[model samples]
Target: MASVTYILFVSSVVQAQEQANIEKLGVERVNPADVKAAEDIADQILTKMAEGSYYEFKEGEAIPEIVQLFTKDTQKQAYQQIKAQVGEYLSSLEFQEAYSLSQGGMEATIFRFKGDFSKSEPEVRVVLDRDDKLAGLRVLPWTDQL
Candidate 1:
């Protein structure tokens, strides 16, 4: 019984250490390289929308499953509101600029998209895990004069 307890405790410690390592290694660098990579993503989104309606970027593994689920449920409504203001999907839009780079225990990239002046400002937020990899993106609903 003593040996079994010791083994379990060791195993738990190893597992926790491994998780910490993964988080440390995965935390993507917050530099121009990362910013450009994200810009590439925004560019791809534009290209797909220009090509056709069925375009989608490949999913990043860093993104959590629950976040994906939420996106699935609310994407349509969220996009509808944004499209009404922005003129199309994420394509045909420019990353006006990053309004803020707020870092909490988890960091976020908050940016504004340039759309029609007549419409309300449409914004997108990308949440990152401890390692700085994208965990999910949230598109706010439209607040224009519908």
Candidate 2:
């Protein structure tokens, strides 16, 4: 009975997120003449993120499948659950710095955030498609020791 309620809640959230993604991406045609425009679109999206307003653009909803790469699916409820755990960890600490890297043809941005959690910094990577849509996300609480 309790499990059924939990499942229903999660399913509702996923369906809501999927709808939000469709609206956020919208329906637009891209072409050579729109190259700069496309870049602008990406820049606008990233800039908004940098400003610390991170959430689904469609309002009152979570971003959809920010971890699709690891799951190989368009929607990943498991990924969303893992992400919430990581987000909680970050939110619990007093963060000091945020560093970002986008290199070597990887359509992803890796952000390192230092916080009171430990001497080890937590990191997040967001991969985006050519249309500037989110493809996936990875969160690491600490750097792997070699």
Candidate 3:
């Protein structure tokens, strides 16, 4: 079982209430199987975006349908933004860590990869909800923290 964990977000988007809830996460451990399943979904989505496909992510595999918080256009925009900042997505790093987090009323697992791009290597974060839905996903400026 995963131990109780707390996350502190200093981002401008996070408000006091949300931060409070986020700090309360970490009561149970998520199954490794769940992590793998979620990662597979994240990989598929990221791969498409990285390849500049900009297609719908929930393609053919509709069994465990993923309801993402972001829309198709949003996904495209985010990835495009990342691509613009970093350049083409040459490949994902050879090895990276996946993070599991639960806070407030949200529980999710994330996979962060050092994306090798044409000009830079930025951090790509993918988050999936406990129900295996897409909770959040984004590409952020590179940070060595993870």
In the range 28-124, model 1's lDDT, one tens digit per residue, is: 3334454555455444533443344322435553445423443432444434544555445434344444422332233444333343322443443
By summed lDDT, which 10 consecutive residues of candidate 1 come out lowest? 1-10
- For each candidate, the alpha-carbon lDDT, in order, equals 0.37, 0.30, 0.52
lDDT of 2 by residue, 1-146 (tens): 01110101122222233332221111243232233332333233333333443323433112244322222221234334433443322332221222222333322221222322222334433333444444433334544320
Where does candidate 3 clash, by residue pair?
2-29, 4-26, 5-26
Candidate 3 structure quality by residue, lDDT tens digits, 16-91: 3344333322325445565566556556766776765654645433223233334466567767766567777664
Model 3 weakest lDDT span, ten residues long: 1-10
lDDT comparison, 2 vs 3, better candidate: 3
Ranking by TM-score: 3, 1, 2
**CA lDDT, candidate 3, residue 145:** 52
**Candidate 1 residue runs with Cα over 4 Å from true position:** 1-30, 46-62, 65-67, 70-74, 89-104, 108-124, 136-146
| Clash tally for model 2 | 1
Relative to the true structure, candidate 1 reaches a TM of 0.44
- Per-model TM against the reference: 0.44, 0.27, 0.60
